[model samples]
Target: MQRGLRSFIIIWIGQFASLFGSALTRFAITVWIYQKTGSATALTTGGFFAMAPTFLLLPIGGALADRLDRKKVMIAADLTGGLCTVFMLSLYLNGNLQIWHIYLTNVILSAVEAFQYPAFTAATAMIVPKEHFARVSGMRDLAGNASRIFAPLLAGALLAILDLSQFMIIDLITLSIALLTLTMVAIPKPTQTEESKRAQANLLQDVTYGFKFIWKRPSLVILQSILLTLNFLYTMGNMLIPAMILSRTNNNELILGSVQAVMSAGALAGGLLISIWGGSKRKIKTVLMAQVLTAIVGRVWFGLGYDTLSWLLPSFFVFFFIPISNGSTAAIWLAKTPPDVQGRVFATRRFAAQFCLPLSALLAGPLAERVFEPAMMPGGALASLFGNVLHTGVGAGISLMMLLSGIIGAAVSLLVYVIPLVWRVDEILPDHIAEPSSLIPEKTVDSDVGVKAPEGAASPAD
Candidate 1:
């Protein structure tokens, strides 16, 4: 294997294992909580605590990724996060685990995650050539989707056969392997430039600098605006889908599971296809096309599904387009952003895109339960208008939300394409041409392999 790709593969393998174990633990904990409390509120609160800290701390994390050794950041995160899991295991083994205990552990893990993600994302750019950016993103997506597809089933089987604490133990073991792998690999450091040096003088200035970086670029601003709208609508739809499925299936867990599996399968397939194809040469086009396709297939067809097959078949297309869209968008950022600043920039972008998630989550339930549900009921307002197509039923309100959200999402996607700034974002943004000096050092190269070439000079893969 080429040296750069070799390093990436080693890191990817470790992360893949870590993701699988984390998924197992997550599934087990979610099930354990719901089974114990039988309250969605408790479950939701757990999720909120898990994500809130990470969301609030992302900017600081990005700053650290830019300033600190990426590998050390990852190692420290893993060690601390592993300790949280170990603590959970102890509580569970002693039969003293409380909901608050789980919440506290998740808070600690989230804090670790704020650092871990930026470090890992920045580290990836250090190891992977620019030409392979989309492919690498696809590979990462594949790992995540694989866990999503299989983890629940694995967790279910294990829960039936073994103790829940065992899952935490398994998680700790995977984390150890991940930490060990981090130790073996070497990540390239960014070449210190005058601007980077200036940015590092004050931590507060550095944290805010990420926001300014994106704000200063008109094309990026347009792209981010599009993403913000898209993610908000997307989250709203996601928040309602499960309830819609349950109502449609009469709370049939089997159908729900099958539908989820199909969606995961689609994402897995999409990631695999992107890895091979590397997407469009003009990556912005790839992103736009995927967005439009998903708005149509995912929002429209998904909303219009009247039966099990109708509901799930479109899901395959919905998820299939997501990775393509996300990978292409990531590729654009990877191509445009400086490696030294990628951590902060990427984190800022992520924060902006996801900032609306909690709000959407908070509103989705109320929107469905009170507004859409009541409005879709017999003799209620708009019942006559939508009831014929969507039907006045348990899931009908969710279906209505789906249809509306999809329509808005599609319209916004079309509007994005019409905007000249967003349409030509790739052309307008400057690509960062990396120097070999920022990557692997000559002394570190194997005598057999000789010196490593810089990413910019490396020939595209055959």
Candidate 2:
């Protein structure tokens, strides 16, 4: 392997390991909290605390990533965040653990992630060749899928065998491994630009610069809006999937697990495929195609599943398309944004992309209870139209909602694809062309900065 690619691999391995550990701890803590409180409101509150800090601190985190040594920033985030796990362990050991403690830990970890995400994302631009961006993104998604599959199973077993405190220790060990790998490899800094320099004078301006950058690009603005809308719809549909499954299967947990596993398998397959193939020359078109495929296969089939096979089959295809769309979109952003400014730009992207998710979460349950469920009940308004096909039952309303969400998602994808601004985003937005080393300018170097490889470490084109 090329030197830069080798380093990227090492970093990826460390992160993959650390993510599994973190996921296990997260699952354990969530289970612990729910068991202790037995209140959905408490659970929701914990989730809110966990996610809210990301929005609040993302811009500031992005600024730090741009201004500081990215590797050191990651190390610091890991160290501090791991300390929170240690604290939780101490609390659990002493029998003083409370729901509030878990909530606090979630918030603290979320704050740390605000710093970690931007730094890691920016660092990726430095290590991987532009041609490999989408592939690397697919690999990252694969790690996420692996973590989702691994963490819960491991956590469940560990919880039965040991305790939550022990799980926290595993997370700490993983963080240490990540820190070690970071120390062993150098992460290139983005070369300084005149604009980057001016923004450094005032952090607030740097933050605003991210917003301004996206706002000035109409194509990017349209793309961001599309993602935001999709996220909102996805969240709404997700909120009701469990209910649908339970109602259809007569509350069979085994069937629920099997269906979810099938979904993950589909995503795993997609990630593997994308990693090998990268994507089409027109990344935006690839993304749009994936989105349309997901809407039709995931939503429509998910809504129409009247039996186990039907649900399992369609959901596999649904998840199968997710990584293709997501990875391609990530590659487009990575290519368009200058590495130096990626931390800020990506933070802005994440912030805008996720802003509507909370609203969807808050409204989904109430809408199901007051409107959709009632409307789809036997002899209700929507029953005459959709009930016969979907059946009149507890989950009939959610099924209709899923069908509508799919139709809307497909319609939106088609609409966006036809819109010249979104359809031609890649062409309209110029790619950031600079040597990776130059992006990591000397001005940002410090004692902890990673050592660069020899000049010949990269291929000629790189």
Candidate 3:
């Protein structure tokens, strides 16, 4: 097996273990918040608390990834996050648990995550060969999806039987395993001297430079816009998904868990398929059309008011595309980024992509509960138009939102295509831009090995 492939498996297993524990905890926390406060706003606040700090710190984290050793950065994040859990677990065990404790924990964890996502992603380029990029991406998704499938049911059962404090111990064990995996593997670190030199400017200037890097690169910018809009739609659907189920069904835990499993099953299948089938020749389509469309299809299903497992059969197929889309994009970034700069570039990318997630948490709950649900529930405004195609109700109204979101996303994709500059984004990158060494061959020795030399720089022999 390829070294990258071997390393990928080791890392994936660790992340998979960590994810299972995380999923269970997420479900438990959400339920805990709701049960304690009985307010949607409070729950939204909790979600915001978890993500906002991370988003704000992404630029700083990007700089760190660019300047520091990524392996150390990752280990530090794991350790910091794990320690927070230890404290939370201790508090919960002592019957001193408060919602404030969870909020504070989220903030610290988010700060740590700012480092973890980019480091792990950028490292993949060093370990995996270009040929296996998509497969590696697929396998990564498989680990996460597998966790989603098992975490809920396991968590729900455990939470029902065990105390939340005990659950923390389980989480502690899983995170410890993830950290162990980090210890087991040796990640290759390319020299970052040039990257460090370029980043000598002030923090604001550094962040501005990152934006400029993308602003000048049409492909990356366009892709970011698509992702932004896609995230909004995704968040909207995600916000409503639970509310949709909760409104119609009595069983909260089972509905949430089983539905999650259903979608995760789709992602698992998609990841497996991508692992085998790879993706379309136009890798962008895998991000935009193939896998994204699959995710959108499930949104349409939810909007359509189909709850029974038989009725939700199509969701399985739609769910399959998410990991494929994510994996395909991962391949694109890994393949295109120069190793030295990847730490910064990918960190910014993570920062930008995630910036909107917290916004979604803020907007989704209110929109679903107040605006969309009310407008479309029990003879509301859009009900008649929706009724023309399907039954008129809150569920139907939300379905309209899903269908419209997909259409809007499609239009956005077409508009992006027309921007011609977007298609040539790779061309607009800096002269020094180098592809990851694992993905390409570059003769000159530089800190960021992947960067293409200035137009005239001759090969080493020259």
Compute the lDDT for candidate 2. Answer: 0.72
How many steric overlaps are in each model, in order?
0, 8, 7
Model 3: runs farther than 4 Å from truth? 192-205, 387-400, 423-462
Winner by TM-score: 1
Candidate 2 residue-wise lDDT, 258-302, digit = tens: 665567677778878888999999899988998888889888888
Off by over 4 Å in 1: 33-44, 94-100, 156-159, 243-254, 377-383, 436-462
Once all C-alphas are superposed, what RMSD does model 1 give against the true structure? 5.5
Per residue, candidate 1 scores C-alpha lDDT tens digits across 148-244 of 5676556766776867788988888877666656655664577665556656757788789889988989888778777778776766666556567
Which ten contiguous residues of candidate 3 have the minimum total lDDT?
453-462
TM-score of each: 0.87, 0.85, 0.85
Give me the overall lDDT of model 1.
0.71
Instruction: Indicate the residue-level lDDT of 281 in model 2.
Output: 92
lDDT of each: 0.71, 0.72, 0.64
Residue 27 lDDT, candidate 1, scale 0-100? 67
Error of 3 at 122 (Å): 1.8
Q: Cα RMSD for candidate 2? A: 5.8
